[model samples]
Target: MLEDAGGHVRDADDDQMRLECGVFGAWNVAESSAITALGLHALQHRGQEACGIASFDGQLFHTERHMGHVGEAFSGTDLVHRLPGRYAIGHTRYATSGASVIRNVQPMFADLEASGIAIAHNGNLTNFRALHTQLVAEGSIFQSTSDSEVILHLVARSRKGSMEARFIDALSRIEGGYALLALTNECLIGARDPLGIRPLVLGELDDAYVLASETCALEMIGARFVRDIEHGEVVVISGKRTLRSSRPFPAARARPCLFEYVYFSRPDSVVNGRSVYDVRKRMGACLAQETGVDADVVVPVPDSGVPAALGFAQASGIPYELGIIRSHYMGRTFIQPTQGVRELGVRMKHSPNRQVLEGKRVVLIDDSIVRGTTSRKIVRMVREAGAREIHFRSASPPIKWPDFYGIDMPDRDKLLAARKTLAEMQEILEVDSLGFLSVDGLYHAMDAGPRDPVHPQFTDHYFTGEYPTRLLDREIAEGRNDPVERQLSLLVTA
Candidate 1:
């Protein structure tokens, strides 16, 4: 049952790449709702637009979704009372495949003949549009526009007798990168996509089993990390906490998203047995090796840029300093600001530190430049703070192509790197010099050897446009299908 709750929605209006969602689930744990809430807190960095939790109190499923952060949505212990259960699952959403509305907030629940299930998904299904069209033609009603809801309808309409069978049936029919959590009355299930383009970790907390998008979530709830849920693997944790595993898809090389290291995963988290923080540091060191810049100080853009800047400074033998201070409290849309004030967008989140930047040749390091709007503003801010010269460095390679998996990125045409030459980008950002880490450098930093031309070690498609899965939705949308299929699609819409 869905519970109406109050929350403060913070809209995102930035150039940073956004992960679609984060999923967390706990089985056979005391105060499972509370445990799930704690895990969601750690995964909140993955998504911030909406959050929800669904619990099964042995007999009934209780759910509460709010349009905001997990901390605000599930703030009080009263939530423990409202969602009493030892089996629970939660999701934090940013909406890449659906509108950011309360209705689309998940741990999307459905009552089926086998059981009541709540599924929380991270990443997008490339075949969602086609499947959605087919499902609608079959008279299945959908509550949310989210591609994830299509999974529910598929499972519901499956001919399979068991819940696990039906769930696998749904997964087999969908295509794309996804790490999913499903909580049913009998068991809690966790599965990762065939290529492992996304991430999910298995953990054990006392007598209970846990699953989350990142290991940081396991750490947050003091769970012992057992292992990563392997590519194309499905793990089912029974009500009695007995665990079983299956691989329902063909074996494939794991190609986890490279952005998890470059920007997405929490620095403290371990992804695929690699420390995210250490990998980012190596990325900076590689970038420094590739494009060393002479400067008075290496200044990070703050937060996400700090680790890479430290690595750059160390590698280049340049001193590191805090050239920009970020305000944590600044909401994207705090209030209606005038046009002039809106134009100073970066100033709301970041302020120049004159003491560090004044009269110095500054080397500004950032994770990556998306549209380059924020980079230009930050460059102007540093210049206004009396920096004599500014050289810009991006730890990750220029993102020339858009992502279709889960990262919310602008189209290829809108990408600054996609359209502009290196010199043009330098001139546009008004930086004395600009350099981006080479794609090979990124691979070296991740300790993945060189990127394979035929089979990449990681999903570096945002930079390389070598997407691992077929983009069925994009193909249909771009009218790249057979004429017969196009006619059928048009008729379906009509």
Candidate 2:
């Protein structure tokens, strides 16, 4: 089955990491909630668990938050009608900071002493546990267990005179990657972390200013791309249609997540001045150059693998074929709520095309391998379809470290590449051969030159264990001799 743009297929979920959320905000737009909904729809690939929109209709703030796809939650309901406004902010969440539940759904709203504010955040907070512990000890009653709720509490406790100042104060106290959008009675605010670990873009539509996680969101609402919000910068769009900008955090080298180019972002979107599709194609070409194999046909794993497979075919001068067909009607497997059904979902999601694979040497191109479970199933399916030999290629390097920055990655023990050698991985997957892109090749694809050993250009600890920000939670937990701590130590040592 074809993976839903709104959510990952159930079986694929185990093998793919999930981005935390996608955020969108607009100032001075008519029917702002509807427009924000469209923006969230375009950004559905970023998160698929829950969706919410909060809008200020000149007098009062209206909100609609529900657990489901954006279209399911907004299209068939009167939820949009209740959210009439000129300013708005929205979030589509894929639980990373908290458990997947309605209480964790965002565009988390707060009615502070100064004014009401609604925020949609995209990136995980590395110091979440520390901040949460401190805030709770200070008598702050959290509405949800989500790390995002800490920001709301911080804003409420800030002694700053203006709401904007309070917002900036709260942000400065927090650490780690964030691309957030906030809506207040007077203005819409957007900000990015100092290191730019996540993406945030600015756009304009008619008299309105738009802020979204990806350019595709802006394009969906007929907005013109206005350059990315610089790292550490804060932008405020007033109800009067005036736009102001500032830098709240000290200047730092920007290191946007490299995974955005590999798997997280939409192929149609542009992030950090590069086309994601173009970058993925380059990654495929680079992988082909590193390990070109003799094969009768180059087949994409489907959906996410299409562009890369095309590039691999172009580079290797092999015929590209759709050897596997995906079903579009299958819902996410994790939602099955039963182990047996969830396991069965893997077969329902995809089927091998015997005519294309029969007696042919096939090269399979995939974006990445997380657990090797799905890859094993795919290889077996292809083999059963009469494939004589199967070679697997990953566009990204082996992911050895876990991501704490908004990506819901498995623990170190569950990672196939983290625990297994290349030969072991090939043996486990039962493939003829397996190859992965090198870290240097990834940098070349990004056109960022070779990665600097001292200071890497991107947030890529998943491949290289050199983390960009402090992992406060992990550090605190590492002192104990627990299994998790031991695993973390092994990762560090590796």
Best by lDDT: 1
TM-score of 1: 0.95
Candidate 1 per-residue lDDT over residues 1-494, each given as its tens digit: 11100111222334667888999999989999999999999999999989999999999999999988888889886988999989899999885323678888998999887799899999988878888987898899889888899999988888888899889988888889999999898999899999999999999898779999999999999999999999999999995768999998778898999999989999999999999999999999999999997799999998999999999999999999998999999873466457676667778789999999999999999999988988999999999999999999999999999887888777777689999999999999999999999999999999988878888899988899888987777787778887686545434320
TM values, all candidates: 0.95, 0.93
Worst 10 residues of 1 by lDDT: 1-10
- Which candidate leads in TM-score? 1
Work out how many backbone clashes candidate 2 has: 7
Pairs with backbone N, CA or C atoms under 3 Å apart (clashes), candidate 2: 1-326, 1-327, 1-349, 1-350, 2-326, 2-327, 10-333
- Full-model lDDT for every candidate: 0.88, 0.87
